[model samples]
Target: MTNQQTLPLPMALNMTLGESLAKRRTGRAFRANALTDDELSTLLWACAGLTGDEGRRTVPSTLNLKAVSVWVLRDDGTWRYDPAKNQLTRSTTTDCRRASTTHQFDFVTKAPVTLAFVLDHDVANTIRESCFYVDAGTMGQSAYLAATALGLSGCIRASFDHKALGEAMALPDNLEPILMFTVGLPEGK
Candidate 1:
């Protein structure tokens, strides 16, 4: 609903299935280089955006629940990913990426883009609680694969203060932060 900038990404990129799979890994170190807005857009689309008029999405949800929403943390601030429109709506002006993880993870805060996967438990009420993890896992893998194919390094991290992160981001009561995926270009050797 707010004014958001949508970047124009190439409709297609040259990547084979095997290449993308091989590229998949948890990248803890990242370059400070900023990810182009277009790459960010494409990454979001590949994760959960609507892919057709019938309203099917890039990733499958339980009963088409589509309960998982992504919040992107960048230098500017935290923004909600609007998959329907393929844009990011600014939510806060403060960068909370540093506060996301506990000290044990050797957390890297320099990644240009950090994606927080927030699940709307209310929407998936019909499904059992145990099943939510399955849905979240599927979405996470999709995001990882997409990032690899896009020539970006990505990692799905579960290390974070869930309650604090949810409150800091001012997320809706129904939305629970599940997984955090940090993405960016790799630093030169």
Candidate 2:
């Protein structure tokens, strides 16, 4: 494990659920500028961060499997979000943002950060495979709303080369990539 980068406390996301839903849309373009730690923290917390003392997450887990793990890909490197500690642990020194997208959607590489959601099948036990996908979608919607509330833009996609991404991130055999949410400031912002 590498040194953990503690995230700044997220700003209060006061937007009503309806408002966020109304504002949310697929990000068509992105600026190259990086998101601040505050923005990244809020966006990530909304995706899968721990809530309350009992250890529930922001997004509901099917069968409470809590099988999805979010890995952040950036220019600097890849990092795994550790919700319990509210920090990011470095996963690899390789920059895998471009590899996280297919050639048709290569534009996504322009975004400063891409969040890859991987499902830990071992943690999921014998549940149906579809259940893990549901968990990923749940977190994706949360990320969309949170991005809208934070004035950031994002696009959730499952179009990447799964095998290549897994190798680039150095994921263990048990982890399966479910989706990737590319995020950043909108162009001309």
Candidate 3:
């Protein structure tokens, strides 16, 4: 995926949902290895990629609004997952991984991929504030299960600086940053 903006992921999964669930584990540390383009593509697809021709996705959404925006922060830069195209669009070229999270944990930057699950306030408010969180959790779980299947590790964190993150991505005021996920090879890998 070097010098490339879009990546196509394999449609078939190597592991079943049950297998992925049983193998799922969290990590607090990570190796410096980078996640392959296919790995990132599959993970993002499992998280929020379109699953059908009817605009359905891998995870359920609140009020069927599909209001959550998945942001990918990597060592190279940041991108926003566009489900419709099944690709990631470059959000910035600044390698804002460190600024993606509040400097609370060192692993945030060490991990190869950091996902910020943002919410569109207008669409989420249509149902309830809690709906957004519920949808976000489902997406996060999708990422975790995919990582487990891929022989990788990841963790979800609530600690992040909203203002700084917004500025880092140059995001609009309507998109509210919520939960986050940091994933990569475990420390020894």
Candidate 4:
């Protein structure tokens, strides 16, 4: 959100809240195809992109701290989303599929995109854990609705190698990987 180069997103999709809610659902199976730039932009916007001035986020957080950091993980690379700027700054160029998903399921990596929600666990440990869960789940649900509205599919999964992912992503020492939402077109599509 600071001085880093930013990628401006396209206009967000116009959809009623009711329509997006009705379409909301979880997805596991994924097709190996790249998402259009617009689709990707909309998905990230729905997750944590800025919707207004003063660093407001789509999902509400405890004290508006917005501790959750979204990392867009793809086969080619990974990036951190800057909500205020509505942009992504590259995190790593090495392939991270193996680091993004767990042994419990392979579909996570199979999906074209995995949005990883990381946090400062030390801060979480010092506070009520439920707040963290609520905030993270709020962001995850936003992604699901966005995917559905775009006729895409996604899954919020907890089964991942946290240590490996953090190591692979070269996360800062203070941060900890918490949850992941995988998104992509269905196989039949």
Best model per TM-score: 2
Report the candidate with higher TM-score, 2 versus 4: 2
CA lDDT scores, all candidates in order: 0.77, 0.88, 0.83, 0.80
Whole-model lDDT, model 2: 0.88
Candidate 1 residues 1-189, lDDT tens each? Answer: 444777575346468878888878877777888888778877777777777887798787777777778888877888898877777788787786876677633435788778888889788877786566666677788778888887778788787888888877877788788888888887672
Q: Decide which is better by TM-score, 1 or 4.
A: 1
| Model 2 regions lying over 4 Å from their true place | none
> Please, what is the TM-score per model?
0.90, 0.95, 0.92, 0.89
Ten contiguous residues with the weakest lDDT in model 3: 1-10
Better of 1 and 2 by TM-score: 2
| Candidate 1 off by > 4 Å | 1-3, 104-107
RMSD of each: 2.2, 1.5, 2.1, 2.9
Residue 138 in candidate 2, Cα distance off native in Å: 0.7
TM-score order, best first, reads 2, 3, 1, 4
Local lDDT at 90 for model 2? 88
Please list the residue runs of candidate 4 whose C-alpha ends up more than 4 Å from where it truly belongs after superposition: 1-5, 122-125
Candidate 2 TM-score, C-alpha based: 0.95
**Candidate 3 structure quality by residue, lDDT tens digits, 1-189:** 443377766446788888988888888789979988788888889889887788999999977899998989887787888888767787677776788776645888788889989998877665778878988999999989988988889998778887788788778888877889899998876
